[model samples]
Target chain A: MVEVKLFASLRTVAGEKGFLTDAASVGELLREAAERYGEDFAKRLQIATVLVNGKNIAHLRWKRTRLKDGDVVSLFPPLAGG
Target chain B: MIGGYMGKVLQVDLSTGAIESYSLPERMLELYVGNKGLGARLLYDLLPPMTDPLSEKNVFIVTTAPLTGAGAPSSNRFNITTKSPLTGAIVNSNCGGNFGVFLKRAGYDSLIITGKASKPVYLKINEEGVSIEDASELWGLDTEKIQEKLTAGTGKLVIGPAGENLVKYAAVFSQERAAGRGGVGAVMGSKNLKAVIAGGKKRVPVAHKDKFKDACRKWRQLSREHPATGEELPRFGTSIFVNKCNATHTLPTRNFLHGSYDEADAVSGETLAEKHLIKNIGCYGCPIACGRQVQLHGKNIKGPEYETVGLFGPNLMNADLKAIIELNYQADLLGMDTISLGNTLGFVMEAREKGLIKTDLAFGKIDRLSRTLDDIAYRRGLGDDMAEGVRFLSQKYGGEEFALHVKGMELASYEPRGAVGQGLGYAIGSRGGCHIAAGYPIYLEANGPITVDPLATTGKPGLVVLNQTTMEAVSTIGCCIFSVYMFLPKALLELNARSPLISKIVRSTFLYGGNIIGKALSWPAWTLPVPAPFFMLPQVQTHAHCTGERYTLGKMMELGKRVVSMDRIFNLREGLTGADDTLPKRLTDELQRAEEPRSKVTLSKMLPKYYNFRGWTPAGVPREKTLRTLQIEEEPMLPQTAMGAASTV
Candidate 1:
């Protein structure tokens, strides 16, 4: 099982903070999460970036990236301030 | 000549109470563009050598660009330019409101105010005429009340008690929006001017009517296509970023001593919108509609922006939304810059904790914050100390190591610990720690598609310089930077249509569908003229399906460069030597490890490189050659040449 955490606007769509996902692939995980959430969650995923251990998931492979037990995944949209 | 402007400049002399109208010199308009650029040139020309910022010698200008009040999306922003009482540098602060668009409709590209008003007075301009009216009745009133007393017609800009009292960090407000930084309000107070009530119905003139209309439609489509700006910003507003920043551990807290706040959710834009939002407000022709409307009591009020959420929310150690909202309202009413005030108050609280002062003004102390604000606005008790600004307070109280400021002005909400490049921008900004003046480092570090070490000083100098130059141009052209994300792809297509240089680049990206090139091009799109609220394009289209008119990029960049260089010249004239461009001691020396988990700022390492990148001497002085190239004369020997005598460095 993998733990996925959603934040900011993504959380508003995800409804819950953390969820358990047994899916092995990133795409399957997202598809399952979106099914439980709403169409907005799927739409937000296009802009909603995934972070693994504080690094962006875009830095890794997209849907093909495999998930492992104990791996922490976080979803976030862009936020900037100065 | 045929396709770019409204063609008129309005000069109002408060001293003699004279109103003069002139067709703006074509060359000046072409080169300076409007807002930041034009205002700088006008101020450089009009201001006497080394004139006191708060003296009768200073001039306060509100300027708009050709794009103002047009149907162009987010292109109607206006700027207020003056000498700053805070850092004694050239101060130009812009705000998104109805005033800029109204001012453009009043048939003037700019309004230059000089001399002292004989008494408490306000200036009213409309299609009929312009007059200086007595405003004793409006004195001591807050911004909401003052704005209420004015004619409900479009284009009224007013100052509140903070400006009237000459608070150094006071701001000039229009409706609920404010020209928040640079002490523009203090200059108004110094001149005994109360407020400016203006409205006009003149149509904004356009260049290239056919092309501009087509361009507008394409631009609108581009905006709707961008996921971040078109959807996110419009839905959640800037406060939406609050959660993102906190999640990344970059949300500034407790006077930038920390990057993440304990109660980030309480002040997040999502929370604000979900809990308190009554309505969403848009500036001029903006499609994003990010402004917040919240009900505090029975009356609706403008909610705290992102900076306010960070500064008053976490920086002050206060998390309750109601407290932040009330304080935000109070500051707005007082015409005070909430960012500066909150930062200053944080310094006081820290000082008190250290026993540097004999007060109990600790973090989360709502009473102290309230008392301090009243004091600063009225220049009373501890307020007098706070009014001296964070830097002076630190100096007097012996906490110089923890003073959170750059060039005397306090830093905005983002903690430098999370991003060193932003710290560099603050230190080197021409307008004393302004974020918008040059905030590229933050973009490069956190929001960019490109990856960079946020805590490193490398590459920051060049980045800061590039952002500053671009911002200077954008300000002059009179547009909001927020539109850059949404409008960039369209801007590129428009530029290619206008200039061959842009076409060559567009052809190189044939491999990636238009969208990939669109994202890549957004990085460099900072160079183009941005659309603002005050200056509206004559006609604008919203999507690819519609036809908007076209404008030239070459002309816009030229005007932007002119505005940036002119402001530099103004600062040089004001005696801002290399010594004046410096960060506060806190960022330079104090270790904020407890609050800021990853705090590491070495401003000393970057200042030299910044100077080099700016074509300045090793000492950080603008090179004589660079100044001459920019058409800025050498400092004129400073009368008896007592230059750098009072320099903090």
Candidate 2:
């Protein structure tokens, strides 16, 4: 099970804080979450930043990065302000 | 006449209670655009070298851009340009308030205020015209009370006791927003001015009403669709960066002694929204609604921004969110800049810990802060020296090494050591240590989701220049700087996520292409005739339509370049040299993280390259060819008034 967290607009689309998924990789987990949410959520996720245990998947293995039980996956839409 | 402009510039001589109006030239409007650009141009021409910033000889100008009050979203920003009482450099403080909108309604593109008033007075403007009225009763009052006493419908800009008492970091308040940096309020107080009110029934003229409306609608839609402007900002406000910055190790802590805080989440935006937020607010005609109103003492009031939170909260090792909210409101009512105030307090705390100064204000001690803040506003005891700001305190005491300021202005909450490019920005920023003026490159370096190597010195000079030029252009056109966040659209962020190779390539492009981009932008407008994409910069199309002017992305960027050049020239004439463009020793000489050998900013490694990219001499002065290309006068005109021998401090 992978623990997923949503932030900003992604939270609004998901309609929940996050959920647990049994997907083996980040891409599979995201696909499952997208199905549970909707096309809008998937569209937002396409542009969303995926962080696995505080590391951006872009710096890791993109969606192909493997995940295990207890792994915390965070999804965030592009955010900026200061 | 431009559709958005009132076509008049009002000049008030407070010494004689004389009011004069002059026509704003079409050529000046085309060249400078408006707001920051126009204000800089006016200051360069009118301000005499070496004139005391708080003296009657100094000129104060408040200006609005063409989009202001033209019903453009987030376009109500007004710029206050004056010689800074704190830094002695030209300071242009921008505020998001209704005053600019009402000033446009009251029939002026800009207002030039000079000469000290004979007595306490406030200037009133309405459709009936302008007049200087007695404000003896309003003197010494808090900002909120003063605004309440003014005419109900008029837009008012008022100062609190802090400004009246001439605190070096005093701020001017309009509604709840403030033009809150570089002692602009002290400049107002020095003139014996209390407030300025603008009210009228007139509407800003539009050149092509249909086209202008269409452009504005598209721009608004773009903002609404963007995840940043549309959702994140409206939901979380600017304080949303707290957790993000903390994650990136960019949160300023312990007087910038560290880049990360152990308990940043306790005072984070998520906590504020869940525990305190009453609702989100916005400036006039703003779609983002990025302002927060939090419930405190059973009443809702303006909440702390990211800068205030970082400086007042984690910087001092305090995690009390409620206390920060209360302090934010108190500071606003007192008309003091929270950024400077917080930085000053942090410095004092560190000084006390180091035994350099005798004070009970220790780290994480929150109880005495409220009283200390009040005392600083009223100039009581230690508060008096504190009111003089960190520079003065460091000068008098022995904490020069940890003063946490540049060019006499306190650095903003972004701890630069974490983002080396931002450090370079703080050092070379025109208005002392302003993050916005420095282009806020930390968004790319650390804060934003997509980022570059935070500790790298390579490619930073060009990055800073690019960000600075783009930000200056955005601000000059009267739009909120937040609009620039959408420039990196959802598609780009998505593209980066899909492929690591693409992300690296894109980041490399930004890093390496920066020098080429900066150099090309430094050239004259004719050399780069291609217009910036409307989707990326909707301001150009909207401005062109509203003013009936031939505006392009190249022309807008050129105007921004010219504004920066003129400001540098003003500083040069005022006697500031290249040596002044530097950070505190703590940022450059000391490391933020022990293990990360490159935690300190390599400012020397970047400055020369930055200068070259900007087409400036190695001494950081603009070259003759550079000035000619930007259409600025090669040499500044002689001071109209007798300026004594320049003081090179």
TM-score of chain B of each: 0.86, 0.97
User: RMSD, each candidate, Å?
Assistant: 7.1, 3.3
For model 1, residues B1-649, the per-residue Cα lDDT tens digits are: 5233555666677777767666655656555666777677677767777888888878888888777776677788899988888878888888888888887677776787887887899888877888899988988888888888888876778788888888889999887889999789989988888888767778775654665676676566666665556666766777876766665556767777777786888888878878898988877778777888899888888888988888898888888888899989988888899888988888887888888987767888786666667778888877877776887887788887778777778887777666677777777777877777654557655543222446656566656665565556655666687764432343332343333343334333321222232222222224444543211222222211111233334333333444555666678767777777666666666654655444677877778866665556777666666555444443332222111111110
Against the reference, the lDDT scores of all candidates come to 0.69, 0.85
Candidate number with greatest DockQ: 2
lDDT (10s digit) by residue, model 2, range B88-145: 9989999998999899889888888888887899999887889999999999899988
lDDT of model 2, residue B621: 92
Best-fitting candidate, scored by lDDT = 2
Off-target runs (Cα >4 Å) in candidate 2 are A1-43, A50-60, A64-75, B634-649
DockQ of 2: 0.52
